[model samples]
Target: MSSYISLIEKGIHVSEKNVCDQDKIWSRYSHDKVDIGEELARVIRTLDKGMPLHAELRALSIGSSDEPQFRILETAFRGGLYLLDINDCALGIVQERIKRQRTDHVTTIKCDFNRIFLDPQKARDFFRDRLGKRWVHLATLHHSLYYCRQCCWLELFKNLYRGFLAPRAAIHAVLMSSKSKDPSTTTWLYNHFAGKFFGAYNDQDLRQLKKDLQRETVFKKAQVLLRTNRVNFYVDDFEKFMAVVWMILLYPQVHRYSLKQREEITQHVYHHFWRKKKPLTQEQDHLVVYKGLGRRGLI
Candidate 1:
């Protein structure tokens, strides 16, 4: 298996053991639910003013993980939902949950977003039967766009906007801003080391993405709105935090790192990012909302 796949498997195993405890997991990041809720509410309110109350709206979520976010989107939109994730474990977990909840409107596809955009024709073919003539009205890529390499993000955005979005559709995204508050010493070290293992983006990358979007003809009519919100993390819960971090890092070939180096990295993460005895708070993320009329002849 590829190192990425192996890392994901290990992370899934760790999650099953430690992070799967619903209570513990919820307690650690319950504020995230609140943050997302507020943002979704804003999006809904804005859309409602222009859309009919009973209008059926299709939605898409990239990197939708096994979380309640998809459920919220389905409930609010009352339409078919397309959820994409590269992690099979996450996709299966979410698919099963949706089944149990009787949320038959959701369709989970296990694949990388990059692959989908790499060949737009294939994407259209794969989704055409299921989607028919409908276009997605609401889409989100929350805390997930970073998974794509910085340079490829613009193309991904172009494909998503052109191929999938309906007329006047809104795309909401939350991304870590390099311009945000300075990282903690541990976070700095973690990013430094982690970048060696995976493709990651900094603030400059995000700025470039925005610039590219502005210059793109497809998004010419798009009105981009930006906001920031500080997210709090539980520093007292080291194991839980690491579980989440490992899942994000998902590049588990530790053979590249010497034993001592691994130990040092772990200690740095725990001390700086986890903050040991102190509560950890991340700098506010840049929440960008893109709204515009769809193009004339795309897809």
Candidate 2:
């Protein structure tokens, strides 16, 4: 198997364990402070103001795992939701949770965005049949872009634009940005430290994507905004944080590292990246929101 696929499988195993032990996972990571749902709700409310009350709003949550973000979206959005993810375990957990809340309005699809993007016609037919429509009013990829292969990210965006998005629809995504003050420094560090990771996006890639969106014929008049925010990282222990980071970064050949090397990396991360106190101070993240009202409401 390819290294990326192997890493994804490992991540799935960890995610399955996390789903099994929800409290343990949340207690270790500071995900509670990340209010992605509120941000998404605000954007939706702002953009959806002029539409008729009964216009039938539809929203999509890509990489929708067993996270609170999906539940929050369920409350904020007026119409049905199409939840998509590659991890079957995560999907099943999310499916059951949403089923408990509202069975009729939520649909879970076990598939990767890369596949859908590659096979546009199949995706169009599948989603159209499930949604009873070809377009969605809003789509979210919250912290999910990092899971896509680097080269395919822009293609994924273009395919999504072609197949699923409504003419006046928008896509909101939360991405990991550089922490350094210098843009060039950030780019260099990202390419050096995380270039090997699947779905990793550096500063340069993001800039190129912005330019590409402007040039694309499908997204004419698209207003894209990339915002940066520094949020507090609260972790009770360093060991737990390191495990989370390993899974998140999908560190290749972790077993190859010697005991001394592992310790060195852990210490570096703890002292440099992680905060020391409660609501630990750490590097901030970048949130990118794209709103495209395709030319004359057509792709």
Candidate 3:
């Protein structure tokens, strides 16, 4: 068997054990609310060290944060493994990282206006090639856009599971987020068909003019797809990889949860999962007391 296949089989075989250990390392999945960052980091390191080439890692998340995943990515990248995840973090950071990397080895699938704006012909062609005859429906395109917008990741693999490959393969899978709506984002989606899919530079009149002309073409394309009743928007590929990133970001306590939750989950894993057979004492927790920490957000 290939190294990647071996790693995935191992991950699947041990997944139940990892989840059902005596200590609650996977409390977050059960909605018990615990931070599993350290445990996540430790598992990633072990996998990288052990498998080196093939290790299955998955991420799950809900919310708009990237700092935690950034830390994981930094660690993995520095470790020379470059295997990581980011679920619901800001998409811009993900895009920026890929742009910075700019290599053929990395498979980057995203549905951001910036990418289309930067290169519309390339974007359209990619969808056409990936989706084949299915790229005829507006709904499919919209769903594809959402998947890329929401679910995106970069990785290396010989073959992917059906969930990762199927959606982009034959049909479009629609996924909707219940998160609070943003007017700017919503507006961008509604105007997806406009000739200038991307917003104009800082000039307001120029932006309006661009949208006006593009809306005509957008409507024309939509009408054509509506008549055919067949649409394809490669949502599956985008989201599966996205799930991977989200899982990586969630580990190491980057998203919402109390500090107590973080420590409890960490302690549970280190003690129970690793066969240590003892709780982590307060002294072993290591609370770094750094000063100059200011309020976050509003940035």
Candidate 4:
């Protein structure tokens, strides 16, 4: 068996007491009933979609880098993956297991995150000249958590894995929260609730999920995603794609204005749950401290 499969088996079979770290995590968030693993998974996927999968392995190209990219990477290292972006100054030797881990055959595509430009040509050239067809690239986009908040893709990912990973705090919030949760029942109901809320089996009322549940395909797919961090490979599985799509749906605010736009909402709901009510000041013991903005009364 592959090491990745072994890791998945361990994750699938581990007892709650053995895998859960509620006490240590609760102190940080205070009060929440969601699953930590799911939450961490969302945050990791968000970070991965926002930046390179292995930014920690590369040197910081000091420039106008986006915050979400940095934020998610820092979170993932803390959650599991084991590599720290040098940009995360607060992190040191906190994770012992990750220190022994190694990353290979990975390269980040450099570009200005602040700018919006489509380069199908450059992308094609990268594959032609740089990474061959066999090489996989998770192209991340640096978007403002505020401007581009409707993460339907994220909600999709969560809903797909809601059955298995929902026990984790992050998935709990996504599946149970007002926006993502089904309006009715709430009692660790993954299959029923997700089908009702996200229309996983109902898009055309095909009811394909009945067969899918028996196959346990989604669980297998989530295992692959957890180990490899690649979503583009499983195009054949619409259910899996919908899970990632759900994650995208959960984004707080969406800047893209189109006719299909459901409502004029921007900023993710989760952002409000944890967004800073006030700007950074000397009083806050921030790990990434910055000098207060100079006088015009705005710093």
Candidate 5:
């Protein structure tokens, strides 16, 4: 067996007590949430400018997971929250939270909108009866654009702008820069390992999306705002760190890292990241779109 496998067998790095689960627990507990939390707050605050004050607002959260956005949006606006996610676990978590809280205005829908979002009629047909023809005042694709192919991005945003977005609304999207070279960065780490093993990684990101949106006439009247921010994730435990590695790599589900490939990635992250005490730095670009804002929206 390779040294990586031996480490897993011996359970020295992750832990011998509760094993991998404990590592995951520590990782989640230690993740830096403040920066992203503040970013969301800032974005929502801006979107709040045009929101209906006396009446409740309508919003859609794409690829919704149990994250800070759900809580923030639910509190900031007293309207229906449509949760769209393809992953069962993610949707389940948010659904459970809603159920436990006895939340009335939250709706969870499990779907893979990658291809579906490209088709306007399909999107409208799917959401028509479900959404009661109530267009969203705000929509968010939080850290979920990785699944969307570059070719589909234009059509996807076009659909939102022409179909889902209300008369005066905005869509906020956050994605990691795919061009960064900083080793501590999540972008670099993905490029390093995924490129080495698979020879390919995400070539499209928020920057490219920004440019694409700007070139299109559909968004000519819309404000395509872009900004950058940094956040880091780290844990002393190897298991926890590996969990984060897998998370970043989109392992097991999205990306099929072969067992041998997994072993290879395991060794690389363990030595270079875990041993060196390097955080998985994520330098993300934020994109916000507002159509027909006039002077009401932030320029």
Candidate 6:
């Protein structure tokens, strides 16, 4: 979470509401819907295919509130795990879990990743202080990049490649398409409602990321793997379903839908989805950037 909003830029956001709502959603089902575990596993497996998962290696997962792939990465990297999220509550939950199940392997940091844009040097130093001699061997953004403005995408990756990621490392990011054609998807809902009400179109999807990784001067040397996966979210409870939809739209934070707009959107969902007993589905685009994969420049 970063941008003009000082609260967001400072990572002062809370996640109690989102956590509760997200629980209702994730508690129901996965893989068939919003299960990115398979793709994450593929990232580790691909990196492991060529490089060994050294015990001392490190990983930094941005927006790790869900703490979905923490253990998977713990096993894959066999090393220090840095859990970063803008929401302190999310960090608290993850920290508690880490304390209960693991040793001092996990370090949770609550800060907006957009701080890099505000102060690149300061942000780098902040992470460096925690990491010390460690450099991130595998970094993940998950579905968290939506909090960042599209303009900052390149800067974020550049900083990661140059200052954070170890050589031969990879950064995996998954984002829902901003221009999805499916009415049951988040992208389409945002485009239809937000576009109509807020007059904004989401251009911050993987296509833009692919262009940057493939054409950017620093990223052009890297190997990129692109794919798409479908995640469906459907709950029998109408309130719970709407909550997940709001989370998907990033309501109040990103769009700040008006009460009327929220009602309209809710009604739309009810009429279209709840009545029909269909799930909200999204086609998420996957992007994996492999540093120094082609024997090219590492950064």
- Cα error of candidate 2 at position 155, Å: 2.1
Model 4: residues with Cα > 4 Å off, grouped in runs: 1-101, 113-117, 135-299
RMSD of each: 7.5, 7.9, 23.4, 22.3, 4.0, 8.0
Off by over 4 Å in 5: 1-33, 252-267, 295-299
Top lDDT hit: 5
Off by over 4 Å in 3: 1-36, 52-67, 74-89, 97-108, 111-299
What lDDT tens digits, residue by residue, belong to model 5 across residues 1-299? 59666665333233223333543453365443455567667766666676556867778888855666678778765678888888787788888888899887888888787756789888788668778888887888876787887778889999988888888888888877887878778788788877877787768777888888999989888888888788777766566666666666656455667666777677767677766777777787778888767655552
TM-score of each candidate structure, all chains considered together: 0.75, 0.74, 0.21, 0.22, 0.83, 0.83
Q: Tell me how far the alpha carbon of residue 123 in candidate 2 is from the true structure, in angstroms, after superposition.
A: 3.1
Summing lDDT over every window of 10 consecutive residues in candidate 1, give the lowest-scoring window.
290-299
lDDT of 1 by residue, 1-299 (tens): 48534443443344333334533464356366567767766776666666677788788888866655665787876778888788788888887887798888888877777777757786687558656757888778877776777777777777777888877577777654554334542234335666664434244345557677888887778865566666565534555655655433332532244444455555655555544454444443444545553322111
What lDDT tens digits, residue by residue, belong to model 3 across residues 1-299?
Answer: 48534433333233223211311232212211112244334334433443335433222111212334334534443312221123324445655665686522222233432343234464446445533322210011111222332212111000111112222111111222222133212122222212132232111121222234235432222111000111111112222221222232232222432444333433333233223322211101101110111211010
> Candidate 1: where are CA atoms >4 Å away?
1-27, 179-181, 185-189, 192-204, 241-257, 266-276, 287-289, 293-299
**Comparison by TM-score, 2 against 4, better one:** 2
lDDT, residue 95, model 1: 79
lDDT by residue (tens digit), candidate 4, 37-57: 333335344334434445432
Q: What lDDT score is found at residue 131 in candidate 4?
A: 36
C-alpha lDDT of residue 281 in model 4: 9
Residue 292 Cα positional deviation in candidate 3, in Å, after optimal superposition: 45
Q: Give me the displacement of residue 77 in model 4, in angstroms.
A: 16
| Collision pairs in model 5 | none
* Pairs in clash, predicted candidate 1: 178-203
